[model samples]
Target chain A: MRISQLSAASGVPIPTIKYYLREGLLQPGEQTAATRAEYGEAHLRRLRLIRALLEVGRVPVTAIRQIIAAVEDETMPVHEMLGTAHYALATPVEAAADDDRHREALALVDALIGELGWQVTPEAPTRAELAQVLVRLDRLGRPASVEKLRPYAEHVARFAREREMDSVSGPREAAVESLVVGTVLYGKVLDVLRRIAHESESARRHTSGHPAAPAG
Target chain B: MRISQLSAASGVPIPTIKYYLREGLLQPGEQTAATRAEYGEAHLRRLRLIRALLEVGRVPVTAIRQIIAAVEDETMPVHEMLGTAHYALATPVEAAADDDRHREALALVDALIGELGWQVTPEAPTRAELAQVLVRLDRLGRPASVEKLRPYAEHVARFAREREMDSVSGPREAAVESLVVGTVLYGKVLDVLRRIAHESESARRHTSGHPAAPAG
Candidate 1:
């Protein structure tokens, strides 16, 4: 297929496709002419996968390149692909860029896993993602202590599991959507709810005549 | 109070204080001399708030600066601050970065609150955090619709709440910890759990007496 045909099949705009090609994210197709190129089913498949990683996984191109390289490498195992995807999905991008704090964050992540006795997978929260937080801390000169994060991790892990239980209804499309929205949006929602929850608690206390004196 | 004194009181280092001063994240203390900068209780207080925004809120310095400025401005309405923080916490950083998408994400979040008939503040994932996925997708384009994300959000959110209900005997410290953990780490954890869930489902289907093709 030609470039336009690939564009039609993949639903990526021609300009975007050209951009990907320029970035070396997508491999060049068969050289049909000095000015034109031909693509194949492989390109189509690659494009779809790319879209999934970007749109759903929200992975960055640099990592995507590495992941695809791993996928294309015959020496690499299928488990490796799954592992990479898992890592790509879970790991943060910052961890990869900053080597100094990456190990520490990983240690924290591991410690949390151990401390909580969580049945978590190998690729939970991409290293880059976690590292990004650490890097920010380093930049802020307030790098979080691993010990400080342990409890945080444990609490979140428990809820992570709980949320999974709530949303995993036969792996339907809607099920995946719930998972994304909950994890992506739940914290803010809870924060809002907690505010109201606090208000309600206060109202109850006031109405019940347990009116605590305001802080002096 | 000197830099060291403020550092000791706030548990922030002198270097970090300097950085905050240089970044204008924290106001400069009274300048005693070329070498000596006298700090005060206000500096300590500012440092604490900065830490809260950076660590707990995971807000960027730029945003933090704006927020702090707004707070200091006084003319800035409380609702605006609430809206900023509300959106900061609830919406994905990248989505919120784009004025249009940010509004849409916020609208959807509001819709969720209304639809669920719950009083909850929706938090957005950080753009730096979400950027990992976007970068990945740029390389590995896949065809995904916004429709698929709904269940993903719901499941994670429900599980988060359920976990909070389970873990917190007192919804104070433990609740706060759970909130952070669930928000930051649950997605990664769920990425792993989903795999296990998929495998378990596969096994169950295969082992059952009823013969059916594998669904994935």
Candidate 2:
């Protein structure tokens, strides 16, 4: 098959496929001409795997590249593929807001450092990232409820510690990779939990007699 | 205090403060000079709140702006603010990769669409996002015990469905907002549950025997 066919089949655009190749993420295919290349079942399978990592796993390109290399080696195992994807998705989204929000974001970062006792850097999901949540909290007129968020925070913290302990048993190389991957995946884990809590709360509210109508 | 003092005290830089004002994400301090302005505790607190939303909540600037407007209006309710933030972080990440690996992402998205019957958009989560998880999965060399993940997924679906049933009695506007927010927070809810599951897995593994070391 041709690159266009691959793109059509994979639901990825041609330009993006070119980018992946330029970035050294995807391997070079059999050259049909100076400008063209031929792909096949492996390419199709790999495309599907790549899509899974991006959609369900939320893996970044750099991480995806590494995994792709491993997958192509044939020496790599299936479990490794799944584990790598899991960790990649777990990474917290980096704060990349425009300059306008930087000050408010920095202040939030400082507050987390000074007040919340978190040892995060400005680059890690900085204040700009959390500002959205604070604004939402403010809008809801429940800025005070951050106190309520504590228990849930603690619940996550405990589990995070547990995951840390579990991660330490690996070989040094694997452990480091796992830690990096774990850090990434932790963000997604938070995402998943937050959703569940909302759903559970809504469920409880309904069972209490105030069956809320679905929003338009 | 002068902008510098505010910066010093708030740990936010002076230029960033100016940027916030320029963007209208933050209100201007007392207008002392045509160019120089004095800020106060309110500014500091508001800045902090903005930072919190950006860093901890991982909300977008546009959303933060809307949220701020709601909070300042005094018309917005507390629960609404809380709910919105929860949802913002809960929505799925966008897809942004173009490789064979993305096929996996497309498959899962298709599965969710076909088998699970969700109304999510194809652009909902990009392949780049899902690839993160795939990389980790690849590294871990474990099957994600999809069997392990299945129960949690089911639990979340049930939780969500139950909530949809319950909120039917609320005022139309509130119910509508709740559903929207519910969809957004869906990701967070899963995060929380997965963390819980990880802990449960950890506890089980720890109690079972020698810790399960990572594969070499």
Candidate 3:
């Protein structure tokens, strides 16, 4: 396929495809002649993944570049690749200026991890991100006690485990790409799903004086 | 109290608070004199809420104004207030150009909502957001069947119900503000927590050659 066909098939514009090619997001197609090149199925797949990350996942192009680099580098351990992808997707939270609140949040996160017996590294980017949320909650004078968040954490753990298992069942490269893409986009999916669920529950609670239907 | 005190209490910079005031996200303080105004507890709380939405929630000022307006409109039903907040927080997804794929994704979302008996409105922004994710998944050639996402939706429903219950225990205005703030921040919190859990699961799976201990 030529660039135009790739754009037509992928629903991306020709100039944007050229931009991606210039940015090295899409590898240069095979040089069939002086002014033309041929793209194969791999190029199409890569373009689709890039579009998903940029448009649906809302990942920045720089981050997408790092994620793609990790996926293509076979020497990088899959675990490390996954870490790269996770970091790329996570929006960096600014650290709280107050040391006391920051330390308190960190300690709370540490205790929660200890209680759950989850083997997360102390340096994981998410630890800081979670701590930042706790700090923000505290500053708002509506701190979320670990006890209050524990059940939700348990549910999150289950979801994460399911995601991990799901990532292991496909071809290695494709699985890695899917894992990264899925992690980013699934967060958005969950957000929308949760909102819909909230609407349902709100209707049930506000319209009637009874609890909602029993959980499945 | 005054603007500086509000800034100090809210931990928002004076310039940012002034910006919010100018943007109509914050109501003007009581006029004490031609050049000075006296801010009260309401101003302080509103300032704090604005800072939370802007700094932590990352909501645009235009959206924050609408959310603030919703919170202040006591005659607005709680359900409508919640809807406004959800709409303000949801990142809109652009529909795919392929009508067939878009329709298929919409049908899948409709079926999922019907199957779950969820009381989501046809115009709910999240319905479109969820459909967009499904479309992106299909474009990637790895469509997420509603059956595959059912258990996740069940869990999301439970979480949403918990959130709704949590929102109802405070003063009406404060509760509405908190709901909006919490919705945005909690989504970030959940993302980080899920990433941490994934790290834990990945560590256990790859390092020990066995699945992690049974999910609690």
Using TM-score as the yardstick, the better of models 2 and 3 is 3
Off by over 4 Å in 2: A1-193, A199-209, A212-216, B31-38, B55-60, B84-150, B153-216
Clashing pairs in 3: none
Q: What is the TM-score of each candidate against the true structure?
A: 0.48, 0.40, 0.75
Q: What is the TM-score of chain B in candidate 2?
A: 0.48
DockQ of each: 0.11, 0.07, 0.38
DockQ sort, best first: 3, 1, 2
Q: Write the per-residue lDDT of candidate 1 for residues A1-216, one digit (tens) a residue.
A: 988888887779999999989988788998989988889877876676676567666779997787777766767543344445545555335326566567776675555444544444454454335555555555444456656555445444454454434443332222333333333333333343443333223233224444432422
In order, the Cα lDDT scores of the candidates are 0.51, 0.51, 0.76
Fill in the DockQ of model 3: 0.38
Candidate that scores best on DockQ: 3
How do the residues B109-133 of candidate 2 rate in per-residue lDDT, one tens digit apiece? Answer: 3443334333333433332344445
Count backbone overlaps in model 3.
Answer: 0
C-alpha lDDT of residue A172 in model 3: 40
RMSD of each: 10.3, 12.1, 5.2
